[model samples]
Structure formats: C-alpha cells, structure tokens
Target: MLDLPEDKILPGTTGPALQYVLVADEAFALHKHVMRPYPNKTLDIEKRTFNYRLSRARRYVECTFGILSNKWRVLHTAILVNPDFATEIVKTTCVLHNFVRRRDGLNCNDELLTSDLPTLPNCNTSRPSNAINTRDLFKKYFMEEGKLEWQHNFI
Candidate 1:
C-alpha cells in the first residue's frame, strides 16, 4: 500500500475525512486503507447499498485488468520469473497499456477478459475495530448525502 499522510484526503460530498482506499472482496481481510463489503447476512439497506457501490468499483478494476491482460498476453500465462522480476514486468505493462490507451483510446475489439485463478480460503481473522468504524462512516455517507439515484435499485 502507498504511504498516505494524515493530510492526504479525498474530497467528498459529505463525510468527516475520506481517505483513499482499495476495494477488496470478501476473501481478503479488512484494513483501514482497504474497504470490503459488509457481511452478507443481516444487512440493512445501508450495508446493501454500500456493497453494491463497492461492487461497481470492483467491476471497473476488473475491466481495467481485462484490458491489461488482453493487451499484454504474457499476463495471461504463469510468469515463471522471480517475484521481483514479475512485479516489474506487470508494472512495465501497465505503463505501456496507459500509453497505448492515450494514443489510441478504446477500440471496438476490446473485450472484458477474466483470468481463472485458484481461489484462496476466506480470511477468518477478526476485523480491527477501527476498520469497521471507517466502513460504517462510509456507509452512512453513502446512504445520506452521497446516495446515488440508481443505487436504490440494487438495494
């Protein structure tokens, strides 16, 4: 994760302090900088709406990776190189992908490609209280001031 100082905050329509965060699926653990959906059971409208919004954000991430995988075929297969080298390769491809997008923009041939990776077991660790509080704050904001017009349809 990137080191963001306390002063680094995102502008929000309504909220105390909106810090940048990464959206994760249920398989991952919750952290102050990582936002995951609320548990599936016993969800209120606020939680449901938050999950939908987070899913929408995750969809964009998936789509961007789809574009990256399609443009860079090496990403589709297993990279047998060292971990550091693999990281560099992925980063270089991302830079190249952005450069190509800037030069050519989206094309008709672009398609959403998903990779089939082995699923890891769900994280069973207890979530930190601070992370839960942060999620609740965002949920409140989404339900109140930041609510979207079509978000109600999902909830």
Candidate 2:
C-alpha cells in the first residue's frame, strides 16, 4: 500500500545501525519485501538480516514491562483518582526498582524478577502475545545489526 519507490526509503540512522530488512506485511503483500544495499557498509549489511538482528535486541523492553506489571500489580488495582498521582507513583516505582538493583551491584539472584508479583494481562500493544520472541532475541538480532552507539561524537 505504501507504493514507495526503492529510492524513497530513507533508512534510519538513530539508535543502532542495522543491515538487511525483511518486512512481511500481510496487509500489503507487495510491501512484504526486504531492503538491502545499504549505503553505509561500515554500519550494516543487508536489510533482511538486519531486521532479524534488531528484533532480538528490543526484547529488553518487554522484559522490563513484565517486571513492572508483575511485581507492582498496579495495573489491575490502579489508583485512577488523580492522573498526576498515578503517573508519579509509576515513576517512583521504577526509580526504586533501579535503586535496589544498583545498591545490590546486580549480584543477587534475579529472584525478584520471578517473584509472586501481580501479572498484568493487557498493557496496550495490539499485537498478540505470541507474535514475538523474547529470549535469545538479543543473541539473534544484536550480534549482526547492532550499531556502535555514539557516546561522545556529536557530529
């Protein structure tokens, strides 16, 4: 449906550089194609392969959500009185979680992650639960598609 020509797809440069990209759009089967021939050889390879790699590295986001929802269970018993207070509570919870991890120097077992926390069934995303793979995603995607994050270089 995009009808985008091969020349118009401006590849993204932010975050991490990637290589091959394979998009399987059932809605627009014509768009279900790969984007190869990256101009920046130093950054990536082919689009299909790059997509495969990127898919894995983004798994941490889900894991973070799971930890937040399961442990807090705030999603179920939400305090829907004041929007601002609710937002503040969420932020505080996240900060406390990070502080505990840092104070422990990440040495303790990740038992807290798997503890008897409340599990929030539906967060927001429209995709089905089994649509994506979580474990080994980093291994599958990052090694090939991960670009060197720019730490100091502004240009």
Tell me the tens digit of each residue's lDDT in model 2 across 17-94: 222234322221121233212123453333334444343333454467566665566743657768879878888878
Give all candidate RMSDs, comma-separated.
2.5, 13.1
Instruction: Give me the displacement of residue 40 in model 1, in angstroms.
Output: 1.1
Stretches > 4 Å off in candidate 2: 1-45, 75-83, 111-155
Clashing pairs for predicted structure model 2, backbone only: 19-46, 20-46, 20-47, 20-48, 20-50, 21-47, 21-48, 53-141, 56-137
lDDT, residue 108, candidate 1: 39
Per-model TM values vs. the true structure: 0.82, 0.38
Error of 2 at 58 (Å): 2.9
Q: Across residues 42-145, which tens digit of lDDT does each residue of candidate 1 receive?
A: 99888999999999999998888887898899988889999889989999999988888778876636776876667778888888998888888888878877
Clashing pairs in 1: none
